[model samples]
Target: MLICQLSDLHIRPAGQRYQGVADSNRMLGDAVRHVQALDVRPDLVVLTGDLVDHGHPDEYAYARELLAALTIPYLVMPGNHDDRDRLRAAFADHAYLPATGPLHYCIDTYPVRLVALDSTVPGQHHGALDAAGLSWLKATLAQDTVKPTIVMLHHPPFVSGIPYMDAYRFLDAAPLAEVVGAFRNIEAVLCGHVHRPMFRRWAGTVVCACPSTTTEIALRLAPDAKPASFMGPPACMLHRWDPAEGLVSHISYIGDFEGPYDFY
Candidate 1:
């Protein structure tokens, strides 16, 4: 099974730009087209939060319009910038989402099982998994131990070296780590809060953070580095899963570039 992960879209209302600079809406459309044109179409696509610049219904409407171009199945979760109720109302047709509550659910119909967690803290920028969420996760994981599972959440559970980004990092992650670490069947933990692509070995598995489809946060490691972002090449994460070999991931950049030159 091939899973395409698109993160941090930050889509704005039609004709508007994100942060009054990045043409996030257009970029998201391009990213969607890029995924559609993939030689080996992905079996599913997951959007890891920040679906809009603000929690406005107009933004969500435009976002839904932009995403309607996708022909493949997709799932979405809320981020710090999103309003849970508004998001839930926007994607009301997606039955996997609960009628009212944290947008957490498990999809087991495919070869790989997907357990998505809601890590967003409403009206705040930091992330946390409350006791109830952790309990739900523990119970969910206990259901099937044999299936190769992928855990999805908006915030990356580990501290990224970038000081500025780490400021809003996942809080109360110790319990989450303990719960996930106990599950040996989990293939990976996928996240998106950080705009740049990142990977780390965590909780007896791997955490893969997908790059943004729009602006990318500057990779500054200094303790006092000022927060900054750039219009770096947008990209997505392609996770290919095989029962025999497990899951392999790659970064699929969005844009037209010179490539495919024969090396003969």
Candidate 2:
């Protein structure tokens, strides 16, 4: 099974740019096209969060239009910048999503089980998994311990060294880690929020954070480093799962690059 992960799209209304600078909508469109053109098409695609800039109805509408280009199955969750209610309403046809409360669900139709968690705390820039969410996760993971599973959430459950980004890190990570650590079958914990690709060993498994389709948050480790972002080469993650090899992930960058030269 191949899973494509696209994060932090931050799509804006048609003809508008994110933060009045980055052409996020265009970038997302390019990403969609790139995924479609991949030599080995993915079986599923997961959009971790921040699907839109302001979570407005228009933005979601445009986002849907852009996403409609995808021919493969896909799932989405909310981020801090997203309005849960609006996002739910926008993709109401996605029956997996609950009608109310946190948008958490498990997909068991594929070779790999997917447990998606809603980590966004409405009206805030940080993320947290409430008691109810943690309980749901614990129960969900308990259902099938043998299947290879991937747990996905918007906020990475570890402190990134980048001080500015760490400020908005997952708030309730301790308990969340405890719950995830108990499960040995989990292949990985996938996340978005950070806007740059990052990896860490956490909860007895690897946590992979996908890069955004928009701006790349500046990697500044200084304690007093000012928050900044750059319109760098955008990218997405492709996780290839083989029964024998487990799950191996690779970064697929968007846009044209000089390549295909044979080394002899």
Please give each candidate's TM-score.
Answer: 0.99, 0.99
Highest lDDT against the true fold, candidate: 2
* Clashing residue pairs, backbone N/CA/C < 3 A, model 1: none
Estimate every model's Cα lDDT from 0 to 1. Answer: 0.94, 0.95
Model 1 lDDT vs. the true structure? 0.94
Candidate 1 per-residue lDDT, tens place, 26-59, comes to 9999999999999999999999999998999999
Question: In model 2, which runs have C-alpha deviations exceeding 4 angstroms?
Answer: none
Model 1 quality (TM-score) = 0.99
Extract clashing residue pairs from model 2: none
